[model samples]
Target: MLTKAAFALLLTLTPFFALAEQAIQSQHSCFKGPFETYQGWVMRMASTLKKFDQEVFSAYFPESKFQQVQQTLDCVDFVYQVDGFNVEGYYLKPKLAVDKKLPVVMFNRGGNGRGGYVTFTRKLTFQAELAAQGFIVIGSQYRGASKHIDNNGFDEFGGADVNDVVALMDIIKQIPDVDSENIAMMGWSRGSMQSYLAVKRLPNIKTLIAVAGVSDVHQGMAERPVMEKVYKKRIPDYENNKQQELDKRSVAKWAHELPANMPILLLHGDKDERVNVAHSTRLAGILESLEHPHKLVIYPGDNHGLTKHRQEMISEVVGWLNTYLH
Candidate 1:
């Protein structure tokens, strides 16, 4: 969720996005998914071709028919209102859910803008996978990550943008079959920071999952200068407020503030180059000192994305969510 590389192809869908925008009524705050949008129509065509001819499918469409490729993973890329701004996000769930009201998994993605956007395949497939497993996987594209949805306002990283996440919590309650009372949140990379801040206000959060998360802004900026530049662009008043803004975003400065009752699962690769593993480990230690309920998993020889241990990470996440939220 940290890398900006995989989002290029998604930009190509801008025309299709414009078409899909017609499916939703802006007056409606909470709309159901599987809408007959132009993109969905394209994917249906691609899926039909993928069943037989790969070459033809590739030739016909610019990308894979990912939306229809999944077995039972139903995903909905949605746009909703949050503090007068249209926030972009998605929700994933199994086509055949066993429960009348499904437990919630609100995911927070990493990256500032197009940099961390994952909707078409990467993030969509990941969240869809969890949905296939029975949880309602809902996530935010924050405010300004406008790949498809014409969202308003700027992404304040963990500042005002956090309200985007919090607003989704209340918004989902209106969406039927969602177990708003029992909620679990997972944040990846910078999304981890958003998760930390969002959970602070959400006492109802059953559990927190931080995958390759950032616990400290200052420490992360020092290690990854590129990320510092990102901070400057996304975080408002970065030039003048600097340390104050960074401190406000950094969970390391206030680890004790987290609820001891709500358990946390910290997943980080020790060899991570983007955000140092020290972020999770140090935060884990602080949480330990504070007697918080948490489990830290440090994968050896893994990078920022934890690409090598993705399946294992998925298992750990699913297992943790089951333990607390299911």
Candidate 2:
């Protein structure tokens, strides 16, 4: 009787397992639309998510906590190697269901140096504000902290930097609940420059927000008396290398090639010291000349970090993203 019962149980389980395998095969068919279509919808989703970042996401949904405040939130960290360098990053999700895919924001950081909270915590002080609001926030540490800088020779916003960012986006799409249609990218300082350059290669970027970005680093540095002095003390051949890399990098000169009518929001402090307000000013000029869709927010008396105006800055960014990505 016991042997007979065991045989019956095995018979009942076999069909269910076969059905599960069939379901998996059906989902993997790769024919058309979202999962089925390779370059079409997949690329489309990537473009949509390219617009969002910490500043905008927090402004839209500012509860502070991932779930209790406003939107659903989850924290995930992953490690990946870019340009032969091991790097790590995190993802922030809103308090929402996986049934309906939500928009995503790519939040990039600035500065060559690392702050204690900046690296280990992965709190995304500014980005958390956005994730609480409603968007998925993704952040990756660009290779090259002071300790690894000289030895790695990693360009803060070089090809490898862009490659890693796009790779992260690719991973985000694999999530069942992420909406491929709504996405954005935003950054400050080095990240700002990274956003400007990465968007050109990524078509899925529905919107872009670059705050105090270095549009033309070579030109920006040469024009700045302080940065120039620092550069001379560091890399004496900065000018020669800068010109050689300009065509491959510099966003200001390549603005015409960027997506037309794609919403772009730029913010900079009038009194920014480290990156200089000119970076935003010059970029705004380029956008105007190209007749692109864009908005420039110049904060009065704000410095590089905009410490006093952070909340206000966050509000403006979230508003811009909602205007476009939503």
RMSD of each: 9.1, 13.2
For candidate 2, the per-residue lDDT at 297 reads: 90
Tens digits of per-residue lDDT for model 1 on 58-122? 56433343435343555556666777777777766666646477889999999887778764545
Candidate 2 lDDT over residue span 85-160, tens digit each:
6555566665456456678888877754242114322343576678776788877666554353233334334555
What value does the lDDT take at residue 234 in candidate 1? 86
Best by lDDT: 1
TM-score for each of the candidates: 0.80, 0.69
Model 1 off-target regions past 4 Å? 1-71, 97-100, 147-151
Q: After superposition, how far is residue 22 of candidate 2 from its true place, in Å?
A: 23
Worst 10 residues of 1 by lDDT: 23-32
Residue 113, candidate 2: C-alpha displacement in angstroms: 6.4
